[model samples]
Target chain A: MEFLLLTEKCIWFGLGAAGFAVLFNVPPKTLIYIAFMGAMGGFLKAILMHFDETNVIISTLCGATLIGFLSIYFAHKTHCPPPVLAIPACIPMIPGKFAYKMMIGLVNLSGNIDHDTYTQIMSETVNNGLKVVFILMSIAGGVGIPLLITRKESSKGMRLRKRS
Target chain B: MIAPSPKNKEIKDLGNVLLNVGAMLLSSGASTGRTRNTISRISDSFGYSSDLLISHRTIMLTISDKKNDYFFNNLKRSAPHGVNFKLLSGISRLSWQVVEEGLSVNQINVQLSRLAALKHYPRWFTLLFVGLAGVSFCRLSDGDALDMVTVFTATVCGLFIRQEVHKMKFNPYICIFCGAFTASLIAGGGLKYGMGFIHEQALATSVLFLIPGVPLINSFSDMIDGNLNNAIVRGLNGFIISFAIGMGLLTSMLIYRF
Candidate 1:
């Protein structure tokens, strides 16, 4: 049963990645490669959360970093730019729940400024807001490092590497 | 060393073509590195070296041959941002082939026209997949079957409205705002009526379709790649889009009192 649930999560993550890829108009050939990377990243996060009992932030950072590394590899293999593959793959892990909660908390505060409810909502809002920032930053660092490293010195050594 | 032969016209035309190609790639949201490399490679194939200055909204190109007579043009325009991998890869391949196969400028022109005319997938196709992607996120978050269906339908409707508004050439921020509003409104309505067991999950996942993943990712890579100017541009673009989405979500929550 545990294995089944994990499989299901991985599958859903892959499907979601495919949907975004289509919207981004990714070339049909590399769609599966990106989907697989997205799925693996997402599954790794789930495994960390459920099996290893890690925090969401660390888990997501690891997953996004993995996606970042794979995106670079695929970019080289397929001769497409890394962003063309990495960006959509990272979409499935965006912290939408936290952002939505942050919005809700702000809206509630505006409505009831003097209540204890307001205080609780404020804390929740701050927490979620911070989570959103950290998650995004982690994803950025995770994905950016690989591309930044690979991009340097490439113009001189591998002029035709990506044009094939 | 100015050669006053008929080849002067050919050189000018070649310069024009190179400028056009650079402009198209820039407008297509290709990063500065890729755009510069592709332009320089194509011009080199024709025995003319080129220089480029690219920003988020403009491209400047100067093409010169052995005689050092320079032809230059600058384009000022804001490019609509959307990622199209096929076009990026196709143009890259074409530019490389220009060097490998020694294709003439006229031949390159024909290929450029073809690349520009490449067909995008239909609106309905993007809508279906974008919606499905939202639903899949819901599933990944452990939303129940009913919640998944709710998210799926809400996202599909939202993206349909977004595509229609985009077709009308509405500003992109407004399009994203409207899309988020419609999707959240449906999800909120479903929650109030007791249709889905997970209110927060559905509301959160339903609007995942508008998360601006591409711009955010691009902004990060741009900064790390040390294109700080372009990185700032892309980061600002991502910020405004996020603000628009927040407005849409908040408006829906206020209306529904959730």
Candidate 2:
């Protein structure tokens, strides 16, 4: 049962990533490569959270970083720019539910409410909103890692190697 | 000094082609490093070195051959940035061809136009997959079988409206706003009727499709590369799109009071 649920989760995220890839109009050939990468990311995050009991932010950062490194490798094999592959692969991890809940909470705050309720709702909204911001920050930091480390050497070297 | 350099037809033509390539890469949503490097590759293949000044909407290019003492410069402004990875990938491949195949300016130009003519997946195809994406989002959030159906219907309709509004030249933020509003409105029915296991999840996740994901990713990616100016511009662009989506959902929430 645990294995089945995990598989379902990975597949859904992979499908979501592929869907965004199509919307970005990535060449059809790249869809499967990116989907596999996305599934791996989801799988890794699931393992971290379920086994080690790590938090979502760190788990996501690790997953995104893995995708980043994978994108560089995949980009070379496919001869596409890294950003073309990396950006769409990262979409499935964006915290949509948290963002929406935060926005809804904010909207509710402007309405009639008691002081305690207002404070309670404000805290929840802030918490959700912060999660959205930090997760985004982590993703940014995570994906940036491969570029920072590999780019100085790889940008020139990698293309030359590919052509030769 | 640059003015003292002699002019040639090839230099001028190469200048135009490089600027067009640079502008296309910038407006197609590539990171600054990729844009700068690709321009460098092509210009180097032409025996010139390019100095690019890239902004959110314009790319200024100056190509100079150190040995020949000739230089040409041009600046091109492009439409608002749109995510077209095909354009990025195609130009990356073309730049390599310029180096390896030793293509001339005219040949590169022909290939570029060919690249531009390449067709994306049909609109219906994008719609269907994006809807599936929405359903997946619904499932991830633990929405039931029926909620998946509701979210898919909402997503397809919303994306169609957004695409139509976009073709008519609506501001991109307005297009996103319209898309979010349509999706949330459709999903809001579930919330109003309390039909699904987690009705608000349907309403909430429905707008996930409007998230300015690629822009956010690139903005941060650019920020990490020490290109602070373009990074900030792209980041602001992503934030404004998110704000528009929030407003759209807020509008829907007010209507249904859910």
Name model 1 segments beyond 4 Å from true. Answer: A51-54, A115-117, A152-164, B1-7, B76-79, B195-198
> What's the true lDDT of residue B79 in model 2?
68
- Number of the top-ranking candidate, with TM-score as the measure: 2
Model 1, range B29-131, lDDT digits (tens) per residue?
Answer: 5777777788888888778878777788677777777787655454545467666766777788788688777898889889989987888778788888888
Q: TM-score per candidate, in order?
A: 0.91, 0.95
Q: What is the C-alpha lDDT of each candidate?
A: 0.81, 0.86
Question: What is model 2's DockQ versus the real complex?
Answer: 0.79
Candidate 1 structure quality by residue, lDDT tens digits, A1-164:
99899888898888888898888787788889989988988888889888666388888888888887888788778877776787778788888878878877777777847777777888999999999998898887877777677665554446556455
Candidate 2 displacement at residue B242 in angstroms: 0.3
User: A104, model 1: CA deviation in Å?
Assistant: 1.1
Model 2 ranges off by over 4 Å: A52-54, A159-164, B1-7, B194-198
Report lDDT (Cα) of residue A32, candidate 1. 94
- Residue B80 CA error for candidate 1 (Å)? 2.6
